[model samples]
Target: MADIKHFDPDAALETTLRLFWRQGPEATGIQDVVSATGLSRSSLYATFGGKHDLYLAALQRYVEQRSEPTFQRLAEDERGLLAIADFFSELVTARCTGPFARWGCMVANAHAATQNLTAQNADTQVRAILDRHHQQLCQALTQALTTARSLGQLAPGTTPRSTAEVLALLAYGINLRSRNGADAHALNQTMQTALNALTPSRR
Candidate 1:
């Protein structure tokens, strides 16, 4: 017979995700996971394998639970440029305020951390997650920009794909800057400036 499990793996993974999101994988240890999840080392290992594996799982959860839904909304919203503006507004609000403030985005944090690692030292799985995330973000932004272009909301020369790439980088910058104590007001101003530049002049 298979061994019976005594704890909720989903709950434990959610708890572990928050721990990793707050302190990041480098600062967090297996002991930290054990402590945060209230699980023994053996149980954690039995369920999640090891530290690297657990971090990957947590990162995947973040992408699925936190990032994807937001992206989906942006891609589907018919308001186009307004939807994108709301997206950035909410992003700045979430990043600069609330319980998770200063944590930045888990994926953005991973990107920064992974950049410091040598190619041989970097985990391919993590790199894949980051790449997928970038693609999803760009795709969503592209969809929104295409909508904006159809509605004559974009600046005359703006191309959806190129502008989506620029906006994706801007989003990453907001995430990183917010982690370093950039305030909501400042971030909002930055976001507005970027959006304004993409808007057609009304004259």
Candidate 2:
């Protein structure tokens, strides 16, 4: 008999994540996982508990693997404002060209699916995490505004706080539109408009 490879739990979870990425959680079934991952039912159940549990694990994996990097990089980079723009640009590029473009953001999709479970909690744990992520972005924008001001990149009297707020709004708006299937060109144009608005020459 041929030797069989052991099931990889991480690999299984990633496969599930991609499926959920391509199709929302409610739309994805256990059979879809089985078909995509080629894992036996018993094995999946034994490894990840069940569908809901598996979905959460997959989302956590995505946060750790994908989302965190962008946040961390922007926070640490010098051209942090430009980094934020690039991040949004990357989002547009990913959704425009990646395999899962049409499915929308997993986190946003979860908002519709998991809102009730989180309704009574003292803090919406999911929203808290997302808020923290956005907060880092706002901080990065503040840093960028500072850098821009130092370089005389802004018009006189353009405060860092005001510029930061504008950038943050632009970032959030990009995310909201992207989740609604906005195109890359539309996002790029929006970003450029925001940039032009914040620059001295355009103001």
Candidate 3:
């Protein structure tokens, strides 16, 4: 017979993801996971392997649960630049307020943390996830920009692919800054400046 587990692994993983998102992987120890999940070290190890393994699981969960849906919406939306504007607006609101306030993006935080790690210590799995995230975000933005150009909303000489790259980096910047307590107003202003540069003149 298979061994029965007493705790909800999904629930525990959600809690673990939030813990890692808020405290980061380096600062969060197994004890912290134990305290946060109310699980024994033995159970955690049995279910999730070790700290590194758990952190990787949490990162995957974060991307699946939080990031992918948002990217999917942006990629499918037909409103062009307006969709992109709404995307940034919602991003700022989520980052600066609510239960998730100040937690930053899990992926962005991981990217920042990786910079401090020696090449030998860097996790290729983590890099892969981050790379996939960047590609997805850019693809969504590129789709939106393509729609915008079709509708004559794009400024003359602006290219969808190049603009998508800029906006992808900008999104990362907002994530990092918001984690550092940058206000919603500042983020919105910066987003607007970028959007305005992409907008066509009415005259």
Candidate 4:
């Protein structure tokens, strides 16, 4: 009988998520996963099914484990707009200074690059996933903006829903720019530009 090994699904999935984040779906191979998780081919197959399934698993893990904190910081924490601003500021700081700055965000990279499938089925699935993530971020931003409005931090007459959409787009843009090797100063300037739009003009 073959030796059955113990595995922690969450930890294994976390490793897989990091691998996929560092390298996109197409670029990551079974051997890479095996190496990262110390799982043999048979174990991986028996446990996770296949590469795509594993990719989906890793994505779910990423959404739950990684995205929740950011969502909380941006949405649940109530410094109104300041929390969002500081989040972006920290993003800028990290991108400019973090050791693995070049890796960028896996979720954003996947959405940006996954739309090129030639087959109809492949195209549909990939596009659906991308759209879903985009809407999720949009909703998160909407919540933050709504909270800011409730707290009177927003400039007068600013609509929470509309501003949220714009801010979500700004956040996406900043992530993309960082992936493109934009520096801290550049990101700071972008943040400033975005904030300026939200700031109320005095009479």
Q: Looking at model 3, report the run of 10 residues with the lowest lDDT sum.
A: 114-123
Show model 3 residue runs off by greater than 4 Å.
118-122
- Full-model lDDT for every candidate: 0.93, 0.71, 0.93, 0.75
Using alpha carbons, what is the TM-score of model 3?
Answer: 0.96
lDDT of 2 by residue, 49-155 (tens): 78777876787777778777776676566663465567668867776666766555665555556554544441265565556655666676677677767766667
Of the pair 1 and 4, which is ahead by lDDT?
Answer: 1
TM-scores, all models, native as reference: 0.96, 0.76, 0.96, 0.85
**How large an RMSD does model 1 have?**
1.3
Q: Write the per-residue lDDT of candidate 3 for residues 84-124, one digit (tens) a residue.
A: 99999999999999999998899999998876555554578
Query: Residue 127 in candidate 3 has what lDDT?
Result: 91
Q: Per-residue lDDT for 71 in model 3?
A: 95
Give RMSD to native, each candidate: 1.3, 4.2, 1.3, 2.6
3 against 4, candidate with superior lDDT: 3
